[model samples]
Target: MNWILLIIAGLFEVGFATCLGKAKEATGNSALFWMIGFFVCLSISMFLLYRATLTLPIGTAYAVWTGIGAVGTVLVGVFIFKEPATFWRIFFLTTLIGSIAGLKFVSN
Candidate 1:
């Protein structure tokens, strides 16, 4: 259950990151809306992450959280923002996913 919460938190991290980018691109009321979304998601992500940490090791939980968020954000960039999906980017993303999996495997 803690792992599930951690994963959900990571997904929220991705959402907040995307909201931040949107907020940066927007202006006036649009920017305010995005900023509000960003704060909401950020708060939820942090809360879930804190809950997960009550049971999981801090270092491992943090790394996994960031890894999931990084991967999800990069994918969002490539798909939604039309960012380049270079070979090296995909390779390193795969490596990060592998490392995250390894961390989960090693954790009790």
Candidate 2:
């Protein structure tokens, strides 16, 4: 359950980050809405992350959380924002995923 929570938190982290980026492009009331959504999601993600770390080691928990978020955010950036998705970018993302999996196994 803690691991599940951690994954959910990671997803929220991606959502908030994407919202923040979109908020920067927004104008007027819509911008405020997106900004608030970003902060709210960010706060919830942090809280869930804290809960997850209570059971999981900080190093493992943080690595997993940030890894998921980073990879997810990059994918969102490419798909949603139409950013470049070069071979090198995907190669690095795969490396990060592998490292996270290795760390989780070793830590366990």
Candidate 3:
């Protein structure tokens, strides 16, 4: 259950980051909405992450949470926002995923 919460929190982290990015490009009411959403999601995600860390190992929890959020955010930036998805960018993402998986296994 804690792991599930952690994953959900990670997803929210991605959501907040994407929202913040969009907010940066927005104007007026739309910008305010995006900004609010970003902060709310970010706050919730952090709280959930804290809860998860109480039961899960700190290193493992933080690694998985941050890893998923970062990878998801970059993918969102590339696919949704049409940001650069260069070869080097992909290479590092793959490396990060692999390292996170390795860490998970070792921690388990």
Per-residue lDDT of model 2, residues 5-92, tens digit only:
9999999999899999999999999999999999999999999999999899998999999999999999999999999999999999
Cα-lDDT of candidate 1: 0.98
How do all the candidates rank in terms of lDDT, highest first? Answer: 1, 2, 3
User: Each prediction's Cα lDDT score?
Assistant: 0.98, 0.94, 0.94
What is candidate 3's lDDT per residue for 5-69, written digit by digit as tens? 98899999999999999999999999999999999999999999999999999989999999999
Model 1 RMSD in Å is 0.5
Who wins the TM-score comparison? Answer: 1
Measured by TM-score, how close is model 2 to the native structure?
0.96
**For model 2, where is the 10-residue window of minimal lDDT?**
99-108
Worst 10 residues of 3 by lDDT: 99-108
TM-score of each: 0.98, 0.96, 0.94
- The segments of candidate 3 whose C-alpha lies over 4 angstroms from its true place after superposition are none
Per-structure clash totals for the candidates:
0, 0, 0
Q: Could you give the candidate ranking by TM-score, starting with the highest?
A: 1, 2, 3
Q: Give me the runs in candidate 2 sitting further than 4 Å from their true place.
A: none
Error of 1 at 76 (Å): 0.5
